[model samples]
Target: MGKEFRCGYGKFEVKKMLKNYLLFGLVALFAGLSLRAYAADDKFYSAEQKIVELKEEFNLPSLSVAIGLNNRLAFARAVGYSDIEKDLEANTDTQYSVGSLSKPMTGLAVARLVATGKLDLRQPVSDYLERPQYTSKFSIAKLAAHTAGVPHDTPERDLAEFIDVKDHQRPMDAFYVFDKHPLLFEPGTGQHYSSNGYILLSAVIEEASSKGYVDYLSSEVWDRLGMKATELDTSFAGQESEATYYSSVNKEGLHVRSLDKRDRSFLFGGGGFISTPTDLVRMAQATYGVGYLSVEALQALSMPVKLRSGEINEEKYSLGWRVASVKLGKDDKSWLALHHGGVTDNAATAYLLVVPECKASIAFATNYVPGQFWRMRGRITSILKEYIDIQSCDRWSFAQSSVDA
Candidate 1:
């Protein structure tokens, strides 16, 4: 066996070859992996460290941030507990009520439908509804843009009624809550934020597609983008992995008992979806993507409503998105950014900011309002900038133009 195992070369030659092989192995190992290892070590680790510190600094029950860079999700993380009392830790998959972020998603859907000739932005609300509740003077575009005269919320519900919702009603049920009320302002004359306006938009979606609003949105938009985790927020009991929304201020954290399980289905078109940050990022990219939404669709959704004075709506509201001009560098020219923020009184704080110039989208949600939107925005923006340099970005607001900043 020893004789059979002997090499054809002498021991000296064998040793030399073995040494050469060892050197080559070492060279390949270092040369092939060193750059990648350094890049990850510098970028990914730095981002992780900052994100962790941000959670502790804010004392949030949970925080999830996802970023799409260069047209793909490059960074995503969830920090803290999704359920603080159950001690359930939040992961990237944790679902929080996305609140008004749902509006832009609806807007994106409307854009696609318009491009495909399935829907029309200029069509009146009467054109889509089985029984048009409002005057036909206003167009679907105005409704989607929140320039429609629709009231901002259900006038039928008292504070108690709003807080104690416990039904899994149809999308049309929302109309009964506000359709009886008069318009807040003359349609297309002004901008008034209205979840009810989007409810009308949802009715339009349902009527135009001959399918339920959620069904059409899920199949056509969310499911197509691989956003399986997003869905209309309902008051069903014990939804798996749902975060308990807290409004009380406590550094230690709010308990499960203090939260209410309200139904969000009433605003399904505007502020009623539970989603993960990753899914929001996906939705943002898809909204900006040409493959999914044609150029005509993009233009239809991108036009900010101009007031009777021929000025852009003071809120800069464009379709479902609130947009602004932003510049990443002092020397850089500004570009349009599409963004929206959502807050459900006791549910969560959510924001989606899409910057097409850099092909980057940032989506973040906190289970509770952290009470420091500007601080959070700056830090999150910095983190993304550090990881991937962005020359320009679109914008989002946390509140009305004055408060949202």
Candidate 2:
């Protein structure tokens, strides 16, 4: 009877051990499959792939892009030819005219002055300059927001030549083109895309800072951001490492020629600066990241201004930036984005978008092909959104833990 009881107990123990081993094996297999799935989900587009795609799709002579995450540059790539004639390859350090994208940098300069009590956003431009020909209560804030009732470039006028005198040696000299022109509407009554308004802002910056416009921007904005490669687009002649501008308008549609004729100094605060994609990304990260600008100053630079009638500005022009909500992915909710773009006559285009919610920023530049700014932005934003989504994935956390382990 004792032997029979012992045999039955042993049989029960063997069955229990077999069941336990099967369960453990299943669990191990499931975990391995889960890890593989997570790694697949973590896959992201490489910078090289993105630039190559953009270059092919746009037929761009040269394209550059940079992405910033957590206030640091995460990716930068340049593809195609800087100068097709010279067979020079574009690179992250290659400089291109950033066009109206210069406004944000100018806006930052203003914010710095506001932070230091050197300038007032609410004060009238008349306060800084001598009595002007056109009398109106146009404030510095309105100028920055493009709501100061200034007219845009007129088709009949060659303001570029008039403003670019002496090869843009004097940025304030641009004011001569529109200083006497009458305001298009009452100040604060409406918004207009006015490069001339920024020219006026540049004048005010000079007066308040007691420094040359470019000099102030260099010391206060570029130097502070550690943007060593950025500088005003003064001239193409004798400029080294600068991408030779091109256009697609020639006879063969592929006959790329230098389009660096315009004196960008005339654009001044509006569009005179030239920089690499990485440098622009660095600037965006610094401006939008904490500890760079005061909370109040950032608000002034990012918040959309209201008209005198309390109506919201339709363009969403917030100081130098265009504030709007961008839908990042097909299923994701729209996210607020502070962005700007610049298109120049020399076929140079620049676009910058900063997603403050994700602490992500992207800047892109093309040496040729203006007017496709939004398309380029969409592609870059999509890549960034995918990366951000991957970072937010639970699998990413697990993967990071494993890496840490």
Candidate 3:
């Protein structure tokens, strides 16, 4: 009886071991299939396919995009025609006017000066300007952050007149357009988005650096970032490689038109820069990472303006950037993103989004300017997040190292 019992127990143990082996094999097979599915989803072609669909849906004349991963530019693609009439294909090298994206570049220029002790954020801008026209105390930081209570836009009549002028190139020249306007409210008590404020900043940069705004940006920011293809958006008279501007004028999508006739000189430090997607991504990574501005200066660049009651500004205007939080995917958490977008009335539209959490950035520009372009921008972000993985880092500690000499 003891021998029979031992034999039965041994058989039971053998069956149990076989069941365990089968379960392990099934798990391994399932895991391999999951990985393959993930790999297929992550393919770059997936993004390209979406872009093609967007291009067709939007009826865009041209679209250029660059994606940066881990502080490195990982992908760039341009589609459609730069000049539809000539059938010139837009490529990665094509340059498009990056509207308000110029603001962050201007902000970076200011930060560079602050880093070298050439300018003070808290110092009154009147100290730097020769005329001293502001009625209330307005600091350089306030101007950079658009919290100086300056009017948001130049008077429509004045802007129209300025746009007609042919040769206004100096930053001070642009100042005449809005210098007569009174402050909308007490400086530092309110927040307003004023391109006029940045126009004044260009003058301040010139006065503080003893350099033309264009030359200073070219030398200090563009050259330093290796952005060889970037240049101020100017008259297209001699610009052969610049993308032709297109706008939707009726139910018909996309009509070719002359670029906005506004004198780029007057646009100055406001919204007058043209760049390729690759160059923009490079600039974003350089500014967000070490080697450009000190950590303190970067912090200042990112610090939101405050009202008199110590309440944060609603717009979240930090120097030249818009600081915000973005959710990457449904299951993923939201993260801080620094971004800016530009849209010319008759020309092109551009967007730059940088996520420090992932050390990734994406820049996009299109020759077409349809009212629905903003919707397309959202779709681009959604498609990109599908492939990009967000990685966490100790942001405070990383920022501290940038400040170290």
Candidate 4:
């Protein structure tokens, strides 16, 4: 009976069903494509518009920018107030803390020592600290990568013990915290973002290379790269022309202050270095070429690490960078992009994709609200992703474009 009815059904009924199905499929396909294309085109823009929009949106009192296209300055702009209280404007000369972006410079210091055969990246921290068995498993490499099982910060017990006992006359020596606390885990077994790790490595560099962290940073990294305005600890109290940092207020606006007055002594090599945005972009570009690290060392600087979760993800820390890739598209059509961010208690900063081949680089820095440098970085990063082409910002292509044009 069923077979007979099916056979009796008109060809029109079958044709109508097929037509509806095909139409539905086509609509779904087009909708998917449209959504994807919108997401991709939605994120990119000319640098000028993005700069204008960001300043207005953030109510940035002042901002300074220097763009390197093909590793050369294609454009440089400064707008708003560097000092709102004094009615001062920020310029390329205005210095901002690159914050933990300083980590990469620390990494370069380590790499420079390695280049000169003065230190080994794989050597154990115990080799230099005189405690081989306890930290034997942790290497110089793990410290730079932040995978050495150190705490995210110096231990709280140490902070409570040390904060008031010694004032300026006593001098700052926060490295003592590591001496008091036990290792969090066996080094290299997991990855954690640790300021303490870099601090310890600072000591290690001092011991291994026989140069203090600041001296090594100057002679080997900053001065060599021609980062003239950059300094360690010199700008802690505030400067005449630099923009004062502001912390964000949850209910309304930003509360501003000076990074110079903050207790920056505790930061040491991990997060203490200060620099302007222009100086940052210049020195950072040096790492991309043979003038700095060898190609192998540069690759090592971006190598990804495994975390405690056992996931093989890209966001792992490498020498001085957080090695992660981003995609701008909803599907596989997007390009892979790399990014990193940094912050001090009074400021936040970032360095994004450098296509050394394009000779283009995108770097940014912002003053934190009165007490919110920590949160400002995430906010700034979110703001940046809205406009940045994580792939196209590469410097090499910018260079080639300059010549071709």
lDDT against the true structure, per candidate, is 0.71, 0.71, 0.73, 0.56
Higher-lDDT candidate of 2 and 3: 3
Clashes of 1: 4
Worst 10 residues of 1 by lDDT: 396-405
Task: Give the lowest summed-lDDT range of ten residues in model 3.
Answer: 396-405
TM-score of 3: 0.83
For 351-394, candidate 1 gives per-residue lDDT tens digits of 88876556777888887776665478767767766654643443
C-alpha positional error of residue 236 in candidate 4 after TM-score superposition, expressed in Å: 6.0
Q: Compared with the true structure, what per-residue lDDT tens digits does model 3 show for residues 82-168?
A: 887675778898988887888988988988998888988878887888553782388887787777877756664255335465555
Give the per-residue lDDT digits (tens) of candidate 4, residues 122-193. Answer: 788788876423567677777677667777655552453344433221112555656566668766566667
TM-scores of all models? 0.83, 0.81, 0.83, 0.70
lDDT tens readout by residue for model 2, 46-79: 4445666676667677788888877678777776
Clash total of candidate 2: 0
Order of the predicted models by TM-score, top scorer first: 1, 3, 2, 4
Off by over 4 Å in 2: 1-45, 155-159, 162-165, 236-238, 249-253, 329-332, 370-373, 389-405
Sorted by lDDT (best first), the order is: 3, 2, 1, 4
Worst 10 residues of 2 by lDDT: 396-405
